[model samples]
Target: MNSLTHSSTSVVRKASRFLLTSRRFCDTSRINGDEETLKITWETSEMDCGFAEEHEKISVRRTFLESTKLSASQVLDTLKQDCPGFNTKLALDELNVPISGLLVREVLLGILRRLSFDNKTRCAKLAYKFFVWCGGQESFRHTANCYHLLMKIFAECGEYKAMCRLVDEMIKDGYPTTARTFNLLICTCGEAGLAREVVEQFIKSKTFNYRPFKHSYNAILHSLLGVKHYKLIEWVYEQMLEDGFSPDLLSYNVVMFASFRLGKTDKLYRLLDEMVKDGFSPDLHTYNILLHHLATGNKPLAALNLLNHMREVGVEPSVIHFTTLIDGLSRAGKLEACKYFMDEMVKAGCTPDVVCYTVVITGYISGGELEKAEEMFREMTVKGQLPNVFTYNSMIRGFCMAGKFKEARLLLKEMESRGCNPNFVVYSTLVNNLRNAGKLLEAHEVVKDMVEKGHYVHLISKFKKYTRS
Candidate 1:
């Protein structure tokens, strides 16, 4: 209980000091001006509260030396006061505490633990400076654990540059990067979609005896998918196989995307074939890929066929999947077909979402079926789907296209009053609709309003012509 009490008090005291030193704190390297208070609700365990256990796995030597959380501001102040110019060689040497002392090292490591918001990034710089200083101190060579720990601090805080520096230092020091470090680094890169670095870290991992072959590869492939690095994605897949790693479902799906992205239709199909041949079924995402491509290609019939194929193959269609097909049919100007398809989707137990309604409504509008579109728009509101700006835009554009200038103008007002902030399309549609209807003065007023609202005129000469008219 005494030790626990002491430890908690020390952390609070460090944080308290920073709050008092407001002047010296300025012009200092802080994260942002966001303040965070660290709270420790849990105190000592029953063992500490009552009698000492005859046997406890706890070693006081290790326990006491283990670095604990201290406020970041406190760490910064301590370093500036005690280890002034921490990055400086002279300052590190002139410190009262020995440069290589455990106390100093503890403080350096302490900056990293349970760091609050605004503390993470600044604390990282301090830790790295300590790491740099460790190299120069003959008595203070950093262990691999130290190397890994420093990298973790940087990695979690999204301090990639600092993380890379520490990794380079680890390699330079002849320290064999552990599987632990490699996996963490690779995972960090992949999670962040650090596309370029994924391959780099994997290549570096090859130098280590322990290569994390599963999650590491998955992480890289997933990240590569994010950045749309098709070439690198293919290369990584190929190299992963060359390294005697089996591709998982995640791996195949990743390669499928790469193939699709690179316009390799044949290759894409081959990948899909290989995925099944390898005994791994494509997840909903994989099926969505096929649906997406068909929809995007404007082949609504083909898209419907894929949907039917998905159902026959036991892939339950979500509202999202149905929405994609609906959008494809809508874009094709097949209002009847899209409506029938939406009904089929509803019958198939997929309730229409707002997107589905919008897509179908857009189709109706596109086909000069304004009344049906208006009814659906109202239905969407009645059902709490809450028509968004795009929905309003479509209706406005539809009215304008149909030469219903009065309705379009009223809709514009409604959109503004509803706090929707009609975008470029809405304003442009209204102005052009007015002009086309020969209401030149009304169109000119809209143009003036648009200008006042800071809307950019993409076609200045067009505006001049309108003004002249």
Candidate 2:
């Protein structure tokens, strides 16, 4: 061999050694990286499915997401095969294992619906826990059905926040939330009178495509009525016709209430006619509320007409129905007619309450029938229903009006003896009666006591002194 050939052979030998070692290292690293990637993908896919074995998780999840055509029972049967008694709590417990998001939602929907109808509280709680786990990834169909189920259950459990959350989740899931659902939520919130988040959720729901239902309009009317937003209420009614939702009985009732609150008698009559024309007869509640409003407002005879109409329509009047009518008559200064209703209410087996007694007593007081008012007070005591402050105040004022200051004083003493702390009205009644009877010193003393106690008797006391002067 020559010198040049030997050097070239030596270089080739070194190059071959380097290539062999580098190739082995490359092959080992490639195999390790591929194994790690596969393991991670499997774990990730398993985690997506709630928790079944890693191998079964993907298959189970696919089956469940494709289960829309299956009935709830059929879906449950499939779960039985895969998870065997697959409730939400059990799925949540299998955290170490894996199921897909879609499958977890399926399990939750089935359990929530079942538990909702069954009223199984433990199952409901577990379903809710799974709901929290599923977060917001539930399918639109599942979201709608589950939220409807939760609304019914929430009503039973009185879980306002959960009801609101389910509403938000349903809207997020692209389900078409309608006014009926919003109405249900609003009615529940209104009855509680202080659910601010429910109000917020309702306003948020308005941004969606679902039109408000008649009941929903009524609820909003009521909420507006609570805050005395009369103008907004009027606008809402106009918007109702524009929205293609025909106002029903509830709608008419709400409009009547809003009208009465604003003292819009013309509007009230129009709405009543509208209701009747729509073939919707007023219910007992309708008559009761309308009568109460008319009696308290300046339209007592209109209330009587409504009461008669309620009877003509074949709706039986409840005890509340009669009480409202009597209150109206009393406010109208119809003492005799009020007494007739009181007798009829008892004849119809409806027991009169303190409110009924107070109205009748006030009626007699207004009509200058002091003897009749005193007799009613005795009957109230005999019935073991202690006279409230209004009852005593009425009798004292009646006696004072009758120039029977002595009797008024005796009742005032009796009131204090019964632990009925005299309010401003009570003190004013006594002062006015005494001053009118020419007992100015006694009237002045009552005024001094009223002022010292920080009672709100100044308005009435000032009027009494002015009258005497």
Give the best candidate by lDDT: 1
Clashing pairs in 2: 48-100, 48-101, 49-99, 49-100, 50-99, 50-100, 51-98, 51-99, 52-98
Q: Model 1 Cα displacement at 233 (Å)?
A: 3.6
On TM-score, the candidate that comes out on top is 1
Q: Enumerate residue pairs that collide in model 1.
A: none
lDDT of each: 0.68, 0.65
Cα error, candidate 1, residue 342 (Å) = 0.7
For residues 1-469, write the lDDT of model 1, one tens digit per residue.
5654454344233212211555555443553434322112223455464445533335554554453222323344555543443445455455433433454446555766546566676667667776676667766676777777778778867887666667676777687765566556665765677746747665545445444436466666675566566788898888778878899877887887788668787787777777776777667777666666555555565566556656666777788887876776677676777788788887998777778898888888888899999999998788788777788889998988888888888888887788888777677777777877889888888777767766655443455476533
> lDDT of candidate 1 vs native?
0.68
Q: Could you tell me the TM-score of candidate 2?
A: 0.46
Model 2, range 9-73, lDDT digits (tens) per residue?
44233222211345433454556777988978999987876455665978876775566424334
Q: Where's the lowest-lDDT run of ten residues in candidate 1?
A: 34-43
